[model samples]
Target: MTTTTQYPECCAKDNGDALGMNATATSPISVDGTPVAGELYTIPPRCGRAVKLKKGQVIKIINTPGSQVCDTWFFNSDDLSEFASMEHTRAFIDKIIPQPGDVLVTNQRRAIVTLLTDTSPGVHDTMIAACDLFRYSNMGITEYHDSCADNMRMALNAIGLRAREVPQPLNLWMNTPVNPDYTISWLPTVSAPGDYVEIRAERDCVAVMSACPQDIVPINGCSPKEIQFTVAG
Candidate 1:
């Protein structure tokens, strides 16, 4: 029997409040000066939202104020099994040496999400997973709102994936300090305002992302910032 549990994946149009944030519309972009606001969108933090995008439409996820890790995931709308796997992502995408425009393809060599832009340019850590309340207090944070954990669980359950399998989240605005020996230190914000990463999914993908509600972690340790989304029809 295919057992399904009540999980936290129904984050469609949440107005973010936990992180002192909100999502507003930015000026629409144009294809050769003809605005395609119907096809593209910019997703903000603390809330998880999904936009149905078609072929050739580009979606941009910006670290609005910069240096905030936007936790993201994507699943094949038809087959969630061949989903976004960090281990498969790292192993196949030359994790030992990732760079700009590098396609983090699936085991089938199909494009998942492209690295259109990266601000904190260096060894990006795909191994370090997303941490939550249970792990936070143990890491010295006594009290923190369970935002990251909530959104992650939501994304997993939304697509029929199990919450326990929530894997390493792709840190869109995080920068890690690399020692001479390649040891990583989850460093502070290296991203400035308006730094964005663009992606055009090759196949129909049900994508989910969270503006991490991690006040305890240094990724957004100082505070949570806002994010914006402008969708093209």
Candidate 2:
């Protein structure tokens, strides 16, 4: 006889739910997410976008306003289950925040993308999970609120794909520093306008980016803004 494990409803499924809409599901850059080389695309405030990149292709994400944080994730084009894993990346890089020249790994421990350039102070965060409805509810928000988690799901769906679960994202430009006491502090980004970071794909993959909609906190300067990116061969 084979044994089957039963899990709670909350742990059993990847719910395709969004509390509100920001056109994340309606607007996709392209039908198949293959972007025009060197064409800049905008991820509007509180929305998300997905792009497909071939091996060796590079994606340059820009902090147009210098205050917005972009929650980024990459999934193997061959298998959506093998997405970027922050925990695995931290172990692989031996650091909480990845710097230039660090190769980001997926859940399968395979190279997905390599950090090629970072023009900012290199203050990013990998310890925090993407914000979701539960987080907002805990913060006493009863109404609908845009969240990175939802943005990701909607983005992937817009591109005709879905993941089994939401993996920890590479929170680019997010400044949450750990203190000596083991506590963390959320602060606004120190990057200047137009500062950008470039990452090269190690394999064919789909990249998703969400302009974090966290307004209750100062991580996004309490006012979320748009972000830009371009894919280059």
Best by TM-score: 2
Clashing pairs in 2: none
Model 2: per-residue Cα lDDT over 28-50, one tens digit each: 99987889999999999999999
Q: In model 2, what is the error at residue 164, expressed in angstroms?
A: 1.2
Give me the overall lDDT of model 1. 0.55
TM per prediction: 0.69, 0.93
Per-residue lDDT for 218 in model 2? 99
State the displacement of the C-alpha of residue 172, model 1, in Å, after optimal TM-score superposition.
0.6
Which window of 10 residues has the lowest lDDT sum in candidate 1?
24-33
Off by over 4 Å in 1: 1-45, 96-98, 107-109, 118-124, 140-144, 155-164, 181-183, 231-233
Candidate 1, residues 1-233: lDDT per residue as tens digits? 23332233333444221221123111112211232464444444565544444545556776777766776666665665555666677777766435677766654557776665555443345666665544555655544344554565544444344333454566666666567998877667776777766676667665556777666547776576665544332
Task: Return the TM-score for candidate 2, rounded to 2 decimals.
Answer: 0.93
Model 1: lDDT of residue 36? 45
Reference-based lDDT, each prediction: 0.55, 0.90
